[model samples]
Target: MILSPYLILLIPVLYLIGWIYWFLKHKRPSLNMPRIISFHKISNTPELGGTFNTVKQFESFIRFLKMNGYKTARIDKILAEPEEKEILIFFDDAYENIYNEAFPIMKECGLTGVLCPVAGYIGKKNLWDRGLKRFRHMNENQLKEMSEAGFEIISHSMSHSDMRRLNKESLIKETTESKRTLENLLNKKIDYFIYPFGLYNENVKNAVKNAGYRAAFASYNEKNDKIDSFAIGRNTMYIIDSKFDLKIILERKPLFLFGHEDQKGRIINWFSRFSAVIKI
Candidate 1:
């Protein structure tokens, strides 16, 4: 069926309006700063009630990053640097599956990564209270083994709660106590900290610095030319079954850049909700 002239004319106008609306809503200056992309948690058993990354998929991501000229630095090394690189991998919540499955493969590939653990959750119950299912925080023996084998063990948090939502006392305890615990366990200094849930505020950053942390990782994915050295950004790689998604992540310069200064998860959560609505 042929469309009427009036209907056809309105289509272009509608398209233009939609485009303008999207542009304004998402508008922000493109950040051309150096970036360091990384993945968190490579386990066969899920944590926090989330699905686990298959061994195959984890391997594929490592291979992809290596081919693209990304290097895995200990969290301390990355934080000590003046600028970030194209790729940097950090594993959150040092689970046994990483040592059992992913570690061997990563060594074979000659890739290094930072392992950030919740020091209080190693032998304790799930501190996040997300329910019990394969809680795999590394014990002292495992931590010692991994530390000797060249994996950098760092701090995630004491209890893995959102830092921005915590009080000053809780924040201090989370930062200082976790560092002390990990240092005592591994017999090494814990300099790098990964914020639980990638959540933080200025107060949190100050607390981390005061606690003697050299660097901290946030969930914000953006080029960090002018990023606060204490509060660096990291990108999360999800367990998707598409090479195209990988390609997009690798090719795009600002795909992970954050637009809001205060709300770290706002942009990502909006996209997640939108994708669900559109069935993408």
Candidate 2:
């Protein structure tokens, strides 16, 4: 059957619209000093967790950040100097793959990042590995080596559970115990907590604060203006996408701040997942 002329024309228009929408969605713009930027997970292998793996991609991202004049900082460093141009990176669960494959390159690039590990999962089979086929968490010795290398070791919950689905007691235990365990292992102050699965409610936030953490990180694409201290927003750097997406992210400040204003980040989360599936 022959297609109608209008339908053929409309197909190109739809494709163009989709392309432009994605182009704007992932673009990163250049900025001057005193800005906050961050990336997560620099492991050699990708997991079910949303992360950008691959040493070459990570190196390219580091070079992209450096070219844009962004400076990397440990989570504690960014918290200490909130006004400074800070790029706080978090490697959730502290996979040993990063130390084995990505650490040397990161150090050579002079990029520092936060390493948030599941306190109880260290030196054990991670839940992701049990069923998801992802790599295991880093061992205690690896965590120590990273700490000595200037990476801020922080909390990523005890079991990587969704805080929004947990009871009050469980939430408290996940936050408090993870912090305590990391502090004991590192022999240093652990003051930051990154919510696992980027899922949390007011109760979880309060639990984190009560657990003696100075700040908590969440997965929201918004510029933190000191008001969202406890629930600081973060932008995910996805794999299998062009670096141009970074340009879109940097340019669209208002989009980042209010992208989830209506649905409260659910839409953004969905879009990111869709992008990943389509290799956007």
Candidate topping TM-score: 2
How accurate locally, in lDDT, is each candidate? Answer: 0.64, 0.66
List, residue by residue over 1-280, the lDDT tens digit for candidate 1. 9999999999878756754543365443234422455554465554332324677888887777667766665554444452433445567677666677778888887776677778878844343424235356767787788788888887998887768888999999999999999998888888878887666779998999999988777765333335666667654555543344555444543333232221323344344334323421
Range of the 10 consecutive residues with the lowest summed lDDT in candidate 2: 28-37
The alpha-carbon lDDT assigned to residue 25 of candidate 1 equals 57
Tell me the tens digit of each residue's lDDT in model 2 across 1-280: 9999999999869756754554365343224212333444455555443454567787787688778876776555555554334566667667777677768877887877778789878977655432135466789998999889888887999988768889989998998888889889989999888887666788988999888888887776333333366776665666653466555454444544323231323454565444334421
Candidate 2's TM-score reads 0.74
Cα deviation at 210, candidate 1, in Å, is 0.9
Candidate 2 lDDT score at position 141: 95
* Clashes per model (N, Cα, C within 3 A): 1, 13
Q: How many backbone clashes does candidate 2 have?
A: 13
Candidate 2: residue 66 Cα off by (Å): 2.9
